[model samples]
Target: MNYRTHIVSDLSEIGQAGWDGLVRAQDKPNPFLSYAFLHALHESGSAAPQTGWQPQYLVLFDGEELAAALPLYVKDHSYGEYVFDWAWADAYQRHGLDYYPKLLSAIPFTPVSGPRLMARDAHARAALVDVLVATQQATEVSSTHLLFPPEEQARQLKEAGFLLRSGVQFHWLNGGYANFEEFLATLEQKKRKNIRAERRKVAQAGVTLRRVRGREATHADWVLFNRCYRNTYRAHHSTPYLNLDFFERIGRDMPDNILLVIAEREGRPIAASLVIHDETTLYGRYWGELEHVPCLHFEAAYYQPLEFCIEQKIAVFEGGAQGEHKMARGFLPTRTWSAHWLAHPSFADAVERFLERESGGIDDYLDELNERTPFRK
Candidate 1:
């Protein structure tokens, strides 16, 4: 088998078919991890050099066949990645070493957990990692990190000498629910009442929710969506990772993977939630509201998406990123993984030390979260 790596400086080199074909055949496929999805992010300017996520996608080829690929970036700052490394960056600063322009393998602005190392088989997967190590060394990047990979992939990376780091994100899994009521029944009485009241508030306020898909959704829909999208960032006193152009391009190019739940009052959109669905799971992505309607966030982000999942027979709903409040709505804590390789010996030593201590605290926290499960035991 012959091997080569592309800089991913141009979109054409990482052809959509070559990447999507591998994704479709994988056991646990996710649209967020697809070529079309990542490319749309770049082409639409959501994840670009200007936004600190410059494409440095790595691809491995064998003869005329595509063997493996990774979505990588030449990062200047860590804004979109949920995993915080600011302290490490500060440590690099204290030591007068550069951390910017390091190598990263992750879905830009996405914190959802799934596969990162894509390949036809284990041998190829392992070989791909070896290639990335050599590439990073040759390029003299400070380090390379793969965030939120599946457990097996993380283990293999650890075997290849990358230090393993663990984190938790909450997700809701369906367990033979005949309907949403059956799901709500699993929650404790107090929590169940709280959720019911939230949903009820939306209906009482004369708000109706509708879902729009892909090409069917209009540019006006995207325009309204971005307005709501920016509200969340503004509330937090920060800027949103994506812009209107990015949202518009994605909706045009990849409608099959997109799901928008629009909440309207008297036929006008007041709140919206944007989600992505593949074969098995629905990922709850960005959401916001133009109006401060009670329980609007839950109705748009959680209840609405959960209803769509059940109607479509999708197995799981991964509420994006961290939200302990998700527990009250039936989402449970699940372990997530990342693999790190730091070039500076002292910084590497300190990070590994911190990770060792952090893992214990994380384990205990997961145990505590599991003990408080909303589902009936």
Candidate 2:
């Protein structure tokens, strides 16, 4: 039981083989769980201290064999985390307490649920939590939060003394569909027609979409994707978190998980959506269009992904976070959990109370979502 803990201050310090080994054994396989994915975030400057996401990765070793690791960050602000804690921070501000410099265990900007704590065995997983709990106490940070953790890991963290928080995300699951039409068959007839109309608009607009995987994605592809990606943010007057180099790097290093659907008209790439997949599921990450075509977003983002999942026989497709628009496309409401540890006793009590009320609201919201599903009776 001799073990030592190493603080991974930089991405280079964490090796992919050692990290991936632990992750492969997990109950759920989320592409975001890969070390390469998180490393890309730091290496590409998307999740660095300069960007307010200081990596404080924790690694455990039992006499030279890497046992477990957590992709932890000492966050100054919660900008990209899908789990909203702005109000929590504001409450602490009102009470004259600092909430910055909190610890987070997550896949940086991605909100897809997967393993947060990686371990070779159950013992290692439990030990990892112990180490994290100790780190939280010793650092005297405001709190430590693990966002979008898989269900088993969430339960394990709860057993290790972290407060459980719940949220909902819309995900499309494959129901043994032979094709996209079979998938639509489960949906209400009106919803089916709506999806068909959306897909038809792209073809009517003379836009044909093509999907390019990893190494197959070229410089021109990156340029087109970034242009579309940035335009989407710019239209909203915000900047993108990822850079062109990051996309290029991931395309080179991790091609199996990267899928880019590009809509082309007159031999020019117009709208593009980026998706990542593993053995189990496809994650619809980002997309934007240079030219606004009617229902083009739905075709490029939702319909294309749904078709791919059905064709590939992938188990699920997570459409990122917070999209009621996804319901009409057959993406159902699924619960996501995060664990929080607060340092201040008074603030902790206050947050716990607030969470109790928020949880009720979330439950009611999920019920409404289910009731509004476009699925046939």
Candidate 3:
């Protein structure tokens, strides 16, 4: 089969249907990988050249039909990426090498792991890998990295000679739970009691949570959610990667997949959490509060989403990125993977060695976390 590669600077060229069709064909289609989500990031200027996330999407076609694609970027820095490669960048700088403009295949500001190399078949997937490596070689970029891919895709990338890196994220899995209470029942008494106490604290503060589905959400609701989203970045002394336009776009384009958990005190919305989900999994992505309320974060971010997941029969709830605190609420440590290829041979070898050591430590960490599971034996 003859394959052709195309570097698309704008996603509009591929169109939503063509892009989302490939995504839907995946075994586990994530909302973040949907065309609406990625296009929102690009069109809203959230992930654009000005923001250091210049789109360099890779598309592979077999004759006239699209076979595989990757949501790639030419990154100027590593701020939004959760994989943490600042040290690698520093080492490059120390050696008078450039790390900026590295190729990254990832969903901007979304750390949830899913499929990265979207393909129709295994052969196309392997061909896409070849195209990715070839593109990196042809470009002046220092490296190419695929972040938060599924374990199966990560393995394929490793077989293609990409270095593998391991990281951990917390995810809550449904065990045929009939309801939130049933889920809690599976947890140890102490942990269940702690969760109950936390929920009670939010209630005692008179903060009632109201879940607004994206279709039901209004312009005012988007305004409030964006405010809270910005406040989260402000609290961290960092600028937000997303803007109001991005949120509004996604809300309009993919309403059914979006969930806005709003916390109201005295009938005024004070806190909100934005969650995105497909049929199988709910992803807790962003959360913030305008007013300080005890345990409000936990209620808005974890419990509400967990309850929704149980009600919707969603199989998994990924708590997003790092947070040992999620464990108390029944989230277990799950391994996440990324694949890397360095243009420089020495740097590539060094990163491979570092990943080996990091992988060992990650294994030990997962073991330690498993020993402290909140669920009852």
Tens digit per residue, CA lDDT, model 1, 48-99: 8888788877777787677877778999888888888888888888889898
Model 2 earns a TM-score of 0.97
- Ranking, lDDT, top scorer first: 3, 2, 1
Cα-based lDDT for every prediction: 0.85, 0.87, 0.91
Model 2 regions lying over 4 Å from their true place: none
Clashes of each: 0, 0, 0
The prediction achieving the highest TM-score against the true structure is: 3
Answer with 1 or 3, whichever has the higher lDDT: 3
Question: Who is ahead in TM-score, 1 or 2?
Answer: 2
lDDT of 3 by residue, 116-153 (tens): 99999989988888888788889999998899999999
Question: Pick by lDDT: which candidate is best?
Answer: 3
Among residues 3 or more apart in sequence or in different chains, the pairs in candidate 1 whose N, CA or C atoms overlap within 3 Å are none
- Lowest summed-lDDT stretch of 10 residues in model 2? 11-20
